[model samples]
Target: MLKILATADIHSPRFLDLFIKSLNKVKIRPDLIILAGDLVDKNNIYALKHVYEILINKYEEIPIISVFGNEEYRGFENKYREMYPVFKWLDDEYIILEMKELKIGIIGTRGALDKPTPWQSRHMPWLYNYYRELPLKISAMIDEARSKGAKYIFLVSHYGVTYKNLEGEPRNIWPYLASSRMEKIIKDKKIDLVIHGHTHNGVRDKINIDGVEVYNVSLPARREVVLIDFTPKSKVFGLEKWLYSGG
Candidate 1:
């Protein structure tokens, strides 16, 4: 069985204690830890060290992979990557893991939005074009991973992919929050599983989009580190016992 522990939107050290408490309760050590995004609160560079140290202390050699969030900002991506050499950061890129019989390929990104947010429009006008082209780039990357003999594919993003998980979020802002464009690629590419964050009020933690199971591992919403078990037989066990509503 392949075990993956995932959580996101930690934002800053404010959620560090909750995250650490949750980790202590996990009896089975996961093979991998995935941070979807937003580790720091608005690019609080110093606070990010605490987050990394806590995980490193608990799971020394376990590989930790991550994508950037809005808080990480745009131009500072290189800075974050250089600062934290411990994490394998993916920006619309992929990494393949060989776990016994299963070869897992994970593609991570900050994700795209159908409509740019007001702040994005005013501050980063280039995003208007970037979002349009990201899905195509992601599709090519998926093909590249498959050619490399990746049996199982995982799509990890910082933004929601399906509206089904955004029930509690206002409908008007849904386009700004995520991209239906990327969702199309997910369906077309036959993605095995999708893990994402950035939706704090998302009521549905998990949903299926055209047979692909999508998980919202936002820390503020789920209030616990989400554990996923994938077996060689293609059976999946999502340990919901570890998850509870924050409200």
Candidate 2:
């Protein structure tokens, strides 16, 4: 079985202490760590060092993969990559990892919003078209992973992919928070699992999209790290209840 720990929206230094405390209580040593994004606050790139220190000190060289969040800022993507080569950062990219002879394909992205924010629409006019095309681009990536013999496929994004988890947030603003387009890809591809964050006020952290498990691992919403255990046979043991038990 492959054990994974996932979380996002650390906004580093702000929630760094709480995150440290939370990690200290985890009894399971995950095979993989997924940071959905927003590692630092408002492009405070340097703060990621503190987050890196905390995780590295505890997990050592355990593979940690991440994606860019909105606060990560598009222009600084390469800078973050150069600064931290240890963490594999994926922005609308895919990487295949072999663990226990199981090939796990992780597709990471900042994700798309059905409706771009006012600031984005005004400043980044191309964003509207980009968001519209993201679903198809991601779908192609899934096919690539499958062709490469990936037994399990994971979609990791910075933005919430579905509105089901955005229960507490204002219903009318759901389009601005995530894209239903992504949801269609998940269903069509039958992705093994989906992990994302950015919705801090969401009430449901876990939901099922056509039997595929989707988790909103925002640190603020769940107030804890999310744990998942998966096997090569496509059996997933969700640890939502287990996490609350002194994790």
Candidate 3:
């Protein structure tokens, strides 16, 4: 079985000490950790690095996967990435982790988020360029992962993929929160699970796209790191309730 711990919109390192302790309390040592985005507060590049270092020190053997949030790109995306060489920065790309008996493929990107309908306003063109062209690029990455013989696929992004997970946010900004294009990709990608952050005000929303499960793991949404399990032969993948809510 493969165990994964996922969180998002963790804007600071204040909760990490407790977070690490909680993991120990649960007796779950995750093989993989996924951080969706907003890892730092504002433009404080140092904060992201400092928190990441703590994670590296604590889980030295674990593989950490991450993507950049809109805030991370405020100025530190490039610089912050260069500072952390121990982690996997999988923005707009794919990686295959070959487990003993199964292979897990992950395709990640910040994701495009243009409005789906004409009623919604167009916005965030500054970040929208990626929100514009990333879908097609991400599709290729997904295809590439399948070609590499991945048994399961995880689609990680810093933006929401569907409107279902973006509920509770202002209706006016729906277009800026996630892209319809990404949802279109979900239909074809056959993703086993979709994980993303950015919707802090939203619930721990779970939506089904075709057959794939999409989860919004924003810090506020989950209130803790969520542990997910996957059986190699049975191919069962889902949240396993091995965590606590952050205070």
lDDT against the true structure, per candidate, is: 0.85, 0.89, 0.74
lDDT of 3 by residue, 29-117 (tens): 67888988877666567777667766788788899999887667644556777888777887678899976566888887766677433
RMSD of 1: 2.6
Ranking by TM-score: 2, 1, 3
Clashes per candidate, residues 3 or more apart or on different chains:
0, 0, 3
Count of backbone collisions in candidate 3: 3
Which stretches in model 1 have alpha-carbon errors above 4 Å?
A: 234-247
lDDT of 1: 0.85
Q: List the candidates ranked by lDDT, beginning with the highest.
A: 2, 1, 3
TM-scores of the candidates in the order shown: 0.93, 0.95, 0.84
Q: After superposition, how far is residue 32 of candidate 2 from its true place, in Å?
A: 0.3
Candidate 1, residue 186: CA error in Å? Answer: 1.5
Collision pairs in model 2 = none
* Model 1 lDDT per residue over 1-247, tens place: 6688999999887788888777777777888889999988878878899888888888888989999999898788899888888899998899998876778889999999988999989999999999999999989999999999987789999988767789888999999888888789988988888899999888888887776778899988888889887555544323232452232
Clashing residue pairs, backbone N/CA/C < 3 A, model 3: 112-131, 113-178, 113-179
Against the true structure, candidate 3 reaches a TM-score of: 0.84
| Regions of model 3 farther than 4 Å from truth | 13-26, 74-76, 115-129, 232-247
Question: What's the residue-level lDDT of 116 in candidate 3?
Answer: 34
